[model samples]
Target: MANTKKDILTILGISIKPGESKEVNFDVANLHTSTPVNVPVIIERSKKPGPTVLFTAGIHGDEVNGVEIVRQIIAKGINKPKCGTTICIPVINVFGFINLKREFPDGRDLNRVFPGSSNGSLASRVAHKLIHEIIPHVDYIMDFHTGGSGRFNAPQIRIVEGERELNDLAKVFGAPFVLYSKHLNKSFRNTCAKLGKVMLLFEGGKSFHIDDLITNSGVNGVKRVLNHLDMLSSKFKVSVPKKDCILIKKSKWKRAKYSGMFKASATISSKVLKGDILGNITDPYGKFNYFVKADNSGYIINVNEAPIVYQGDALFHISTKLED
Candidate 1:
């Protein structure tokens, strides 16, 4: 007979046996008002042990779309995996989520304070707890994100370009594009890489709001990934992105030439050529209007949403990988 006994998975002092789904609260810190803040976690362990996958969101409290994506997956179709385990943390920064901000109450960027220390600041301590306690157990990770304040991003996956494993997973995630960006200092992505876990980041829509297109793509992407890992039921048909996902190796931002009221001429996913007028910053009194033209031909992945802009403000994130 085969050995059915599997290694126990414990998080926040709570043990989840195989074929179990547990919802638990992980106490991280307290507010100035003495309100206890906790990270809500959901774990699903399969009867057949395999890879442990982590799905995290809400590192920035104001980014609500990611939270919705998690809810979509759980409420719509995702159940216990057929093999391995799945852990989902819809909100990681409870303090920031409470205040609708990106940073912790102590004004620290939670995403930038990874590998946290137990004896450090609130963000640092939370990071420490996550890095040491949660991350070490997971073999794969997907951290969801969205456009920052006053910015908007098309549904996309951002991964470290040269990492084949992660890049392959990103392709399986299947967004409009696979974007390569510089790794941030002390970010969870960097920390996970150092620990030898395959992690990728997904971005879509804008902060504080939801777009059906972006949200649907996100939920479907997660399902596809699970299917690829053979964690889903055989009866389930995997999904693909609405369009072919382009691989963007090189991208640049077009900046405003003059400080004024800004307007965009092209939206996300639109293809533009060199010298295309993407947007303009006009003088308040309408005396002068400056056109922000693309320096090179590319696809628009992100667009600035703010009405006002200063010279050199980034207006569009364009990828040179166009055609097909």
Candidate 2:
């Protein structure tokens, strides 16, 4: 499996009143020249009281599908939802975002340091600021992501194993599949869960590029989850049909055997049986090619398209559910 409702929203020293909405830019960091960097947040309080849902995107900076998904949500307006408040932070790592990198300029992955120390590295400080100000107030969170550069991901929801409610929400998301994964230490997903908060991570498309196929599906999934949880007054047209959501317990990644160009035989979401040739890795001149066979039957959730590759480079991500 892979992985919201509303509340009174307050952050950046601003307190939002019930039945109202406000957008605030939070000053969290500074430049060497004393320039201030701000995180943009939109808080909409429902007329009726309920749980709060935190929608976070751009944590990796390069991943923009989440950014677009959140942007459209704010643009479309889910104000005065049936209950609770929707707090949207379209971009968290402002530094990485402008740099188009996943880590801070000082070189730290923000996602790896959670409930961060107040007086730590730049990444830690930023993580601390966000966790202290945001995570505690929310009942549930949706962290968005996309494949790293040069990789394409099949739209899917990944959640930590064994949370019944979270599992249900993942289904409501209606992605092509659901992946149950173990939590990464200090990651937003793990930290939130450690604090007893329910969260989901949505991964799709490729980083940096705007893949509308992922963006649209993400928007609809978020809305569908909101409606399913009774946080929204309306139901969204779930992009993927309910019947299409396949639940998977595990996945495997296939790596390139030799440095060369990769010609893939399977696209994202295409299923293949074990021993099938998922792709071929060959030299630039096509002098010789090695068949990258499928180790397990499953859908090809991710693939690399870069013309050049180094040995051991991940060429495919297989999402599989083994036979019972």
Candidate 3:
């Protein structure tokens, strides 16, 4: 017979026997004030043996939607594991999180420094620890994210490249849409793919703010994925046939033409044709106005929610398809 205890206690480098949940902390950085910051990880092991699934959020400190999603999932409770374990890391960037910023204090984007070296910059060291220690023990990984500050994104799963299995998994997660995205070098998803792991990126809402709709969608999506993996019992039935996801072979960012107050005529997820008027940038006196237009036909996946903008700042992101 196997042990059936649900909650166990342990720290990093120490392993508890099967059938328990343990909280572990990995040291990320030490502040000038002598306070050490750590990444908190929760490991939930099932009574029955199975595959280990890792759920990570807040890689960008400002992205709160993912953090909330992970929290809600853990709060709901996991019963008997159908197969193995579930590891949840709610926040990955402790430093950035503390400051409510997206990048590290050194101004480095942590997501772009993946699979890093131990003896590198602060961000690189943190990335290295995640890549080397946490990622290796997991089978499947889900990294949650949101649009950066002042931007809004529709709830979507970004499946890297054309991996059919990942696409299927994203569909199961039941986001409004799945974005078939090309993987970027040094991204967490790309690093995992290189290691032969299936990774799904969930992006939604705006950073540092809580949108209930996006949060609920994300919570339900994670649960759906767990059910699909047979890690959780399936009790709820999906109401709609899975939506056919749009394949974003490539994406383009529309930048502000000039510094001023801005207004957008459309929201994220809206479809537009080439030369369609999207918004306008106007000076304080309204004397100078610049119109922003879509350059091609595509769906808007990201839009600036803030009304103010500076010249050359990204205002919208559209994904387009090329003619054969």
For candidate 3, the TM-score is: 0.88
Clashes of each: 1, 16, 4
Q: What is each predicted model's overall lDDT from 0 to 1?
A: 0.84, 0.81, 0.80
Question: 140 in model 3: Cα distance from truth in Å?
Answer: 0.6
Report lDDT (Cα) of residue 4, candidate 1: 28
What overall lDDT, based on C-alpha atoms, would model 1 receive against the true structure? 0.84
Which parts of model 2 are misplaced by more than 4 Å? 1-9, 235-242, 322-324
lDDT of 1 by residue, 9-59 (tens): 888889988888898886776778887776778898888978888888999
- Shift in Å, residue 181, candidate 3: 2.5
Error of 2 at 13 (Å): 1.3
Displacement of residue 136 (Cα, Å) in model 2 is: 1.5
lDDT of 3 by residue, 1-324 (tens): 112244332335868557766778878679879887767788878676667788899889999888988887777774235557888888998788899999998899999999998999999999998888888777888888999868999888888666789878887888877777778999888899999888889899999888898888787777777788777855544344356556566778999978999899977788899999999999898599889999888889899988889988999988776212
Please, what are the lDDT tens digits per residue for candidate 2 over residues 152-175? Answer: 988889987778998889988888
Error of 3 at 177 (Å): 2.4
Query: What TM-score does structure 2 among the candidates reach?
Result: 0.93
Worst 10-residue lDDT window, candidate 2? 1-10
